[model samples]
Target chain A: MEHEKTQIERHTSKQFDVELEDVREQVLTMGGLVEQQIANGVKALIDGDSALGEDVARSDYKINTMEVAIDEACTKILARRQPQAGDLRLVLAIAKTITDLERIGDEAEKIGRMAVHLAGKDRPPSAFRQISQLGGHVRQMVRDSLDAFARMDTEAALAVAQHDAEVDREYEGVMRQCITFMMEDPRTIKHMLDVMWSVKALERIGDHATNISEYVVYLVGGRDVRHLSIEELEKEAARAISPRTGQ
Target chain B: MEHEKTQIERHTSKQFDVELEDVREQVLTMGGLVEQQIANGVKALIDGDSALGEDVARSDYKINTMEVAIDEACTKILARRQPQAGDLRLVLAIAKTITDLERIGDEAEKIGRMAVHLAGKDRPPSAFRQISQLGGHVRQMVRDSLDAFARMDTEAALAVAQHDAEVDREYEGVMRQCITFMMEDPRTIKHMLDVMWSVKALERIGDHATNISEYVVYLVGGRDVRHLSIEELEKEAARAISPRTGQ
Candidate 1:
């Protein structure tokens, strides 16, 4: 009787591990969706495509649904498995990650709307150039952060957070230029501001990526580098940025 | 033997409910911390106080630490109790909420940094006016969404989500103004964009709050509102959004 019970216990534990992987996999799947949303949202803006923006808006629901489903899965696992130690940490981090992905999706959708709005506008060369530059940095940050998340790489995550500060400096530059544009032609305020909103959305996306990196640190190393300097963390972080993947 | 078993089962179940409540309470505590972080971060920015921004920077770790702790708590309860149905949803939603709060905190911190950067500069009056408007909306959204959440009010959550569109509109206006500002005087691009970044931070805060409100709907009514009209969801979500303190 004791031997049989032990065998059943081992089987149950294995089953729990499989289920935990499923939850992680689902959260990762959702991460992919949110990442796509960010990219597509940015594309919609740059391409001046309202249809693309609308698609992004529609996809937000799927993102929201995935979030709910993943939350359910993690909760169910936690309740059933009573996982301790490392498993517990992994489950908790994924749960936190779903929330990050969902927000990232929203930012993407916001970008879509901005794209639709900006598609027809005539933009100043200098102002447009910097706006585009800020957007590019922000988008790269999102892609890298998501990669850090998938690879369970704290180093990549830290790099993503540090990258945000540079965007900040650029954003500062963009705003100064925008102000002059506004002063030059009050008529320009409407279009130029759309560019500004898009940059801001991208920056927030970067912040979410940083948050994901922080989660990576907690998941693997079990250390929270959130309050510390990215400079310090980067000193020890993987020197490479999270691979841009398809580039 | 049967009587003893029955008594033990009832005792254990009650214990589970209490622990679940503990998880819910902790999630709230985390939310409160992040919310305060955003407020302080924004205030730090507005006042040009590096100290306040530094304070936000300092608080990031604690927020992250608390996130892990609460996530652990949820996983622990789920593992040990194996809560079904409603209890499971509570654990999961609270877990998701931790993430949203952390993002909100990060956005606030970014705003604080921008505030510090802009402290030394002369900002456009119109830009400041719009920034204040966006800030107020975001701040209100955060406060009321949490209130709706604490109360499990779906209507409140829907209301918050609806308000997000308004913030978007404001963001659009700010962007237009900034772009115009930069065109006329390239020299002001940096300062104008700092203010714009701060506005963007506030707008993202509102987005996070809206996310919190959506989760509130799922938790309270178990309904999925991802694809529905706001009007439909608002009407159907009464049970979810209604303050259910008595219930």
Candidate 2:
């Protein structure tokens, strides 16, 4: 009877491990696709290519499908495995993280839609410059946040959160400039709103990346770092990574 | 051995039922608080009452706390109970629903913050009139969605999803008016942006409400209604609520 019980336990453990890895791989693949969508959307905006924008918009269906698939997989695993402790935290965090990724995809689609509207509209070169700069910064943040999650690097995740503040400041600057241009020329009002909304979408993507980083922190240390100031997060991260730090 | 198995089954089922009820009650309570926050936030905007706006902003912490608590409870239930079939779907839907509720609260807080910024600003009476009309409509949608959720009324849920399109139209109308006003008077640009964002936030609230309604459909019928058109959703709802209608 003891030998039979041991065999059953081993079988279940192996199956659970395989299921967890499969879900994680799919999540990373979804993340990569979302990142590409963002890039393609912004490139369409800068290049004034509505066709490219349409392609990006069309590709979002894949991201949405992936989100639903991952969520369903997570639910099935929870019902079947009932994993506990750190494993459980990882599963829950992954489930939550996918929601943010899906939202990021949605925002990217919004950007793509805006790009389509801005196609062939006369805009100052400086607007494109600002969009490119802001887009690059947020895209790097997204990549780093996902990498942090993959590597379980709490410090890198914390850095992504800190980077979000800079993105916010840049977004405000872009908005001010766009408003100024609109005020100077009434003809530019519609196009400027498009630029303004695109920048807002990019800034929100930065926030979602920050959220993903916070989830990484939670998954690694079982501590939710959301709604915390950078200073507070830094202190918490220090303790989370090394409980005896400064002691 | 058969008698022992039956006794254990009864004990576990009773415990699961109690836990599920407790979580459901808490979720409804949280939903109620969020609804109040939206009303107060919109009132502050319409009244130009910065004091009321500040109150809404401060009250958001309570909503955030409730979200965290409800989420924790759901996670615990998922891990320990390992509920299957309909029970599992209910728990997962509740978990997903709370995230949307929390975001709705955040949107309210954003409106409150914008209201404070717009206090004493010089704006046309038409802007306030438009805001009042739009805010009232979306607020009703929020209330009806919650009521539908509490009753598990699929028809009401489907109706809320249909109503979101109207909110979107009103939002675009408001945006056009705000932009026209800003273009006519450069001095009003900053203030108009605040009003513009407030309306945008309200529209987003309507979307969240729609999402909650979809969750209700999912919870009751074990169907995922996300990413579906309103027409598609209506058909699914019809089939879900009346499984043997065609038969």
Candidate 3:
């Protein structure tokens, strides 16, 4: 009777592991959709493709749907499996990650809407170079943050968090340049305002990515690193990975 | 023996109820702190009080600490008690609600920083009237949303969500006015930019409040009302509250 119960317990544990993996995979799939939305949103703005812009904006519902589905799955896991310690943190992290991902999708949709608004406007001589650069940086950050979460790599997560500062600086540069353009010619105020909004959305996307990376660290490192500096986060991540070095 | 087992089970269940209640109370306390931060942050900007701005910015850490503490307590409860059904939903909603509250605190801190920047600069002739109005509107929304959560009142939550549209309109008006001010006088561009940032932060605060209200709806209604129109959300919330009325 003891041997039979052990076999049953082992099978249940294996099934729980598969369920957890399924949730993680779904989160990554959602992350990929968000990344694509950001890219298409930016592309639509830069290329003045209103059709693409509208498409990207309309497609945000997909990300929203995924978020709700994933969250429900996590809730079910918590209720049924009663995940403990590391498993509990993993489930919680995925729940939080999807929220950030959904917000990132919202930001991308905002950018898409801005793109449609700016489609007929006069393009500055700079051709939105700074905004384009900032968009690229943040898109990469989002991708890296997801990859970190997928691999449960603390170092990669820290790297993604550290890149946030650079993204912020790039965002500042874009804002300053837009202000300069508006001040130089009052006729460009409306156009520049749309550009400013788009850039701001991109910058916020970067923040959402950083939040995701923080969740990755929390999930793996078992420490809440929400408000910590990158340096402090690095220390904590290192300690989480190496027990003997930890204090 | 069965009677003794029932008594022990009852004691444990009671303890779990107290734990859940403690977390909920802590979340409300944190909400109160965040509401104060928004109020103070806006006041600091409107009054040009650099000291107050600095204080508000510095005090954000208190909210951050509370968020971490509350989240940890929720995780502990989930692991130990494995709360089912309604209790599980309560714990999850608190987790999500605190995130929005923390972000609201972050927005308030941004407003504080902008206030410090604008304090040393010229105040607009219009005296930031639009921003102050927007600030007042969002502050009330925050208060109302927290009240809705405390009472689990679906009607109140729906009301708060509906108010978000008005807040968005107010935000757009402020943006338009700021742009006009900058366009009329290039000299006011820098000052107007600072005012714009403060108003943007206020607008984001409104979004956060809407998020919290959505969480309240989800907690009480047991339905994901996110991405739903106010009308649809009202229908869903009503159905969740009264099954006979549900379609």
Number of the top-ranking candidate, with lDDT as the measure? 3
Single out the weakest 10-residue window by summed lDDT for candidate 2 chain A: A238-247
The residue pairs that clash in candidate 3, if any, are none
lDDT of 1 by residue, B1-247 (tens): 9999999999998888788777777777877787688777767766667778777876787887887687668767766776777777777778777777877877777786776677677767777777776777788898888888888777778888899889899988987787677767666765766776677678778877877887788888876555467787787687553556445
Instruction: After superposing candidate 1 on the true structure, give the runs of residues whose Cα lies further than 4 Å from its correct spot.
Output: A1-62, A79-82, A123-189, A231-247, B1-68, B114-138, B155-159, B162-192, B224-228, B239-247
The total number of steric clashes, by the backbone 3 Å criterion, in model 2 comes to 0
Tens-place lDDT per residue, model 3, B65-175, is: 999999999999999999999899999999999999999999999999999998878777564887888999999999999999999888898899999999999999888
True contacts kept of each: 0.44, 0.46, 0.67
User: Could you tell me how far off, in angstroms, the CA of residue A76 lies in candidate 3 after the best superposition?
Assistant: 0.7
Cα-lDDT of candidate 3: 0.91
Clashes of each: 37, 0, 0
Q: Enumerate residue pairs that collide in model 2.
A: none
> Which regions of candidate 2 fall more than 4 Å away from where they truly are?
A243-247, B244-247
Q: What is each predicted model's overall lDDT from 0 to 1?
A: 0.75, 0.88, 0.91
Q: What is the TM-score of each predicted model, taking all chains together?
A: 0.74, 0.96, 0.97
- Candidate order by TM-score, decreasing, is 3, 2, 1
Interface RMSD of 1: 4.9
Q: What is the lDDT of residue B245 in candidate 3?
A: 47
lDDT of 3 at B202: 92
